[model samples]
Target: MTIEGRHVVILSGGISHERDVSLRSGRRVSDALIKAGARVTVREPDEKLLPWLEQHFEDVDVVWPVLHGVSGENGALYSLLRALEVPYVGSRPTAAMLAWNKATSKALVKRAGIATPQSIVLPNDTFRELGAASVIDAISKGVDFPAVVKPVEGGSSQGVSFVNEKAEFSRAMVTAFTYSDGVLIEKKVTGTELMVGVLDFGEGPFAVPPVEVVPHSGVYDYAARYNAGETTFFAPARVSEAVLAEVSELAVKACQVIGLADVARVDFIVDESGKPWFIEADPIPGMTETSLVPLGIQAAGLEVSDVYARLAEHAAARGPRNTPATPNLVV
Candidate 1:
């Protein structure tokens, strides 16, 4: 099924923490698709999504769900797309449930022998009733101070904080709770932060060169992730070939292990030992010029417009993912 001039519907801007960023991504993709000689439309997700799709999906040769976090990254919308019989990008419903949960993603990657930082998942009551001492003790036993505390189910680094002392530990947990019911207090592994973009074009996973992020001191928070000029990205991360190969391999493994397909990006922390520590996998990584994935893809000698066009073509070629529980199949 060739999608030369077919309509591409890009979904974005839901009522989530990353709504603005998602909308920016959607706009970028829409513009790129149009530049590539394809018809494109950008739509915000709301109560009218199903109705709008019911009328327009068939005409839409590919659905580019550029939404981020909850409503977009979660499995619900993906499941809806599957039922609609519309070809959409990114992971399926089952995989999203696992990757969306910080605790679950880490557990799965760790179980698969991928190196992930130790984390303590704290429920709300445990933080309020059990006290910060309990939280500190539990996390301190496995990790040390200068740890990262954030929502167990979150993206774009929302509700994330760095706790350097006992006094800030509880506050960070509270901040994390502002975004989610549970908090993940992870062991801080200080090192160069790297972002790996993995794209599945129905021919296994291929990783775009990794990008090194150098965030200003004490500013690698949510703002730095979405907005511009908060960080510097060095595409084709300056590392040895062996380390790069290993990083790429682990990133692909993490995506495959989580059952993510179509396209996704994996973030990592390359420790002093040069070992990559799995952070989180984003099914709908941002596509803004400031996005890490686009930079890496371009550094790999592929234009952003080509990437978007191929994604649309990939969706049109590969149908639904959840049907019959098959990861690789064309219907």
Candidate 2:
């Protein structure tokens, strides 16, 4: 299957916090698809976007949504796309919703026998009713020091904080709640941080080379993630071959457990003992200049344009979600 001359409408730049990142990702994807000879159109998910898509659906072949935050990853837009009978790249609606919430994805992966960090989910309403002092005290006692506090659902490390002591808990909670209605306090796993991208182009899913992330600030937050010089990345990661294999396998397993399709990225922390601990799974990973998935793709000796093109072709082959499938069709 080829995407040459096919029309690809990339949805990006929603009103989410990650709008800038989404635009960067969308531009990169559009350029890559165009390089593969596909006609590309970049559109923002605004008030008029749905009507525009509905009216121009026939002119579009596949929609590659590079949206990042709640507007994109929460599954609402994907559901509308499905309802409009439009084919798009990435995970399905249910899968996107499941993966959007960090706590839920961690629970699902853990249930699949994966090793995820122990954590507690506290909604803002519950935190308010429980009294700030009591909830903070309980969290400090329950989770070890140097814990990770983040919004229950978000990306780009926008509202993530690391608390090294009890006093920092209050500030961390405040920061997390700024981005989401809930917060997840997780035990910090110390070790090498690796991001593995799982991609499927018609065939079964497979893992790309793992990319090791080393941020100068000792944390891979929003600044380190988007700023090129703030962090150092090692494609294929600088770990033992055995550890690399384990990480790859775990990445694929995590995506499968979360029902992520087309393409996704699974993050892990490989402790000194060579055990990989699942951190979180990204349903729609950033395709910016400093993004890890692109590094992994290049490290695997594959061209980015080709991979994006193949994914678009695969989605187009599947056609609209509402279409009836042939008997014994391999999906």
Candidate 3:
């Protein structure tokens, strides 16, 4: 499956808060591509991304966009990739844009009849124009005290907070607003935190085994994400086979409904009722040492190198399918 001499660019490093982590992911992915024997180049994208690629896109066979959040995940770079006519490894421009914004994603998934926690989107100006009371009341009416507040467009749980008091709500909103223009307030479904990996291969998208995330302290934050031991991920999650099957099916449904292609990691919160609620869809996800996508792939007994090689092949040969994409191959 190796592309051999074909040049692949791993796009990373943006103006987002996750830039450092994205760079680390780019390094790891580049190393894997090198081991897989594909000529690899690492590119840090900004407004100059297009000009930079125009200089090299002709020689590039495909792009493995490792960028997370905003410009990278929201189709900014993917659009450029399309204009340049280089096949990229992750979700398409339109799909990535659709999935990156929390409000857009929630609406689409809810329309698909998936169980998402009660939530509301509030822009910073919306709060400024009105007041914090209205925003807090909106959250209070839908979600009770123990609530989750986060930036609508963020990664690695960068601006996420667990609020247990009304006094802390303002702080949480301010925190999230620093990362994004808007925030989403969701009812904290405290039970099991599971991440289901979805891989869209040549045949179609197949749901890989679920992974249970045990965060050391304040949930899965930036420090907990890249700091390794801060979080423990159990593959094939400890849930029963029936529950696993149900969760996997739901994960695949979420991916398809949101227009995601390539690979996606669907985050879910299983409530006391055993119902899985969609938290959000991670389009680019991550591939650093602390990332869960690579861990899930390895847990399936496939080498990381082989996964990258097959993924390269998948990227080179696959198409952006709104329907079933599980062509004839499975990764």
Candidate 4:
């Protein structure tokens, strides 16, 4: 199967905090697909999206959703796409839902023997009922200091804060709650930050070269992530061959365990001991100019256009979800 001459609809620009990033990512993917000889259409996830898709379903060979944040990663949009029997380039709805919640994904990957930082999930209601100060005091006593506070479900590092002391915990929690109903307070693992992209091109999933993220501000927040020059990325990460191999394997394993298909990105924090601790998984990774996935792709001697196009071809070949292998065969 090939994406050549295929009509691909790229969904981007949802009503989320990451809308601008999503739009940039969608444009990048659109250009890549167009370069690969596919006809591309860029659309936002708006009120008329469903009706438009229904009207042009036959014309769309694949639906590549480049949406970030809850509008894309929480699995609601993917479920709707599935109901419409659309072939899409990304994880299944269930998988996406599992990966969207950092706490849930951490628990799952840890159970599978993947090392993840210890964390606690605190709902906004918990603070409202138990008292914010009381809850923060409890958390400070239970978890280690210098923790990472973030929304349980989000992307582009929005509403994420790094707290170096007990005093900062309260403010961090408040910022996190701004993006989600619940906040995940994780033990901030100190070391190199690496992002590996897992892609499946019909055969099996493989990890792209890991990209080492070094934020100029010492924090990979929303600005550091999307703004060029805010962070420096070292493709194929400056690590030993053995550590690089381990990170790659773990990236692929994390995605497989979470049931992510087509494309994904697994982040890790490697400590001084060289142990890689799983951070989180992105079911729909960013494809923007400064995104890690594209950097890894280029470092691996692969063209972004080829990789994106191949993903579309693979999704098209798989067809709609739950479709029987033999059309006439009765279950």
Candidate 5:
């Protein structure tokens, strides 16, 4: 459908560690909407963002939030958008919040019959109150080595660590706590790491071709994620046809189970047995040039601009879902 004359406010650049990344994504999204014949505004959310929404509420057709990290993916901004009754692209506030926290999202994904790695959630106070040494001792017994430690919420692989030994686990915990109060430590699933993007333009959600991530450092951290070149990505994931189909199916199922909307990028680690284990889901996946969503879009023979335009059109069609939101929307 033609999105001509559709007024879209592309919200990006929040006060988060991923601000730079979010701005780039917002610019790309704005350019795409403009190219698709829509009136676009690239906005950096600030104190005035809510007031601006209130004033121009009638003129705005959709708000495409590209904020990353805690500011964007945490769902606070989505709650505000809903309160303002402004249609926006991406998942609902509740879904976004649920998916924002890696621990909660993994639980839901597992509950949906998807295999996820064995993991544990630790709050900062657990370490402080129970004593760091005690907590570490418990973790050592619970999760196996060659584990992954990361903040419960945030993106771009920031504050993520690969712990090959118990001795190095403390540093990983400290790194994760630097980003968020809660940390998710998982027994690193051994297999092919794949990023599967799912989108529903208007029809029911389906998976785009999976993108396999191979980092030269052997760890896909923040540096490998944004610096480009440090990682080699395989568009069709170099997996067998059956594996590809299974990965795609799992991605779609995860989206449905998580209640994600418009689009979502589900990360997975496919074991040697060919089973795709869900790692996490991004309700607001990145849109930067080096981002995986664009790669998935290209692999599916679709352009970024077209996909984004379709999302905006769908948001306009549905309008905003009006509901009062509390401080916590996870439940």
Candidate 6:
């Protein structure tokens, strides 16, 4: 579809911890869409956003929300868009909520015969009421050493920790709890970290070439994710042909299993034995200068602007799917 005269709103920069990253992503998307001959607006979500959107609803073709972390990924923004009878890119609100929760999504993927790290979910109240010391003892006995502790629902590794020894377990749990009321502790799997980007674009979902991330400090934390030189990325990842094919196929299946549409990034940890273990899926992936989605798109022999423009066009043409019905007259 032609996007020559399309008007798109790229919503970004919400109250999430990844607000800065989202802003950068919105800017990149806006520039890309403009290059594709579409009128673009980069708007940070605020109190007046809904009113403004309602006023200009007919003028806009679609809304491409780049709000990362909680602000955008939690499904509220998408739900609001649906309520407004506006077309938008990415997954529906139900799918967004399912994918945003790491533990829940992992469970769903595992049910589809995917291998994921064994983990436990603990609520803040449960941990505190049960006594931290006792809970720690139970966790130590249940989960193996060298585990990963992170919030149940968050991105950009905001409050993630790697626990190598039992002594470091408490601090890791405490750090994770600071970010979310629910925390996930999984037995850390040793492997090469790989990321796969999937693009549906109205057709059946297909996986792009995988990208291998090599963090300078051995941890892809928030700083390493956003900072330009903090990590070195390899497009068409340095992996065996077998590994690549398996990872790519798994990525597409993960998207289907999680009910994601449009675009998503599935992270995996290929163990030393060459087995891919599903980590998590990001429905609203980062599209900043250092993000992996753009790299994946480029690796697949496509331009970022063209891909985004096509997404906008496809969404606009589809119109609203879950728009609410009007009330009946009381006569």
Q: Score every model by TM-score.
A: 0.94, 0.96, 0.92, 0.96, 0.95, 0.96
The models' CA-based lDDT, in order, is: 0.82, 0.91, 0.80, 0.90, 0.87, 0.88
RMSD of 5: 2.6
lDDT, candidate 6, 299-329, per-residue tens: 9899999999888888888776732221221
Specify the poorest-scoring 10-residue window by lDDT in model 1.
322-331
Q: List the pairs of residues colliding in candidate 2.
A: none
lDDT of 5 by residue, 1-331 (tens): 4688889999999889999889888888888889989999888889988999899988989999998988888888888888888888878788888889888888877776888999999999999999998899899889998899999988889999998887888999999999999999999888999999999876788899999999999888877888869999999899999999998999988787777888889999999888888999998898887789889999999988888889899888877783222223232
Candidate 1 C-alpha error for residue 328, in Å? 14
Error of 3 at 177 (Å): 0.6
| Residue 109, model 2: Cα distance from true site in angstroms | 0.7
Count clashes in each candidate, considering only residues at least 3 apart in sequence or on different chains: 0, 0, 8, 0, 0, 0
RMSD of each: 3.2, 3.4, 3.9, 4.0, 2.6, 4.8
Q: What TM-score does candidate 4 reach? A: 0.96
* Cα RMSD, model 6: 4.8
Model 1 residue 83 CA deviation in Å: 1.6
Q: Candidate 3: how many backbone clashes?
A: 8
TM-score of model 6 vs. true structure: 0.96
lDDT measured at residue 194 in model 6 versus the true structure, 0 to 100: 91
Report the C-alpha lDDT of model 4 over 1-331, residue by residue, as the tens digit: 7899999999999999999999999999999999999999999999999999899988989899999999999889988998999888887787888899898788778878999998889999999999999999999987897899999999889898988888998889889989999999999999999999998986889999999999999889888998989999999899999999999999988887788888899999999999999999999999899999999999999999999999899888887593212112111
Task: Determine which window of 10 residues in candidate 4 has minimal summed lDDT.
Answer: 322-331
For model 4, the superposed segments whose C-alpha errors exceed 4 Å read: 322-331
* Worst-scoring 10-residue span by lDDT in model 5: 322-331
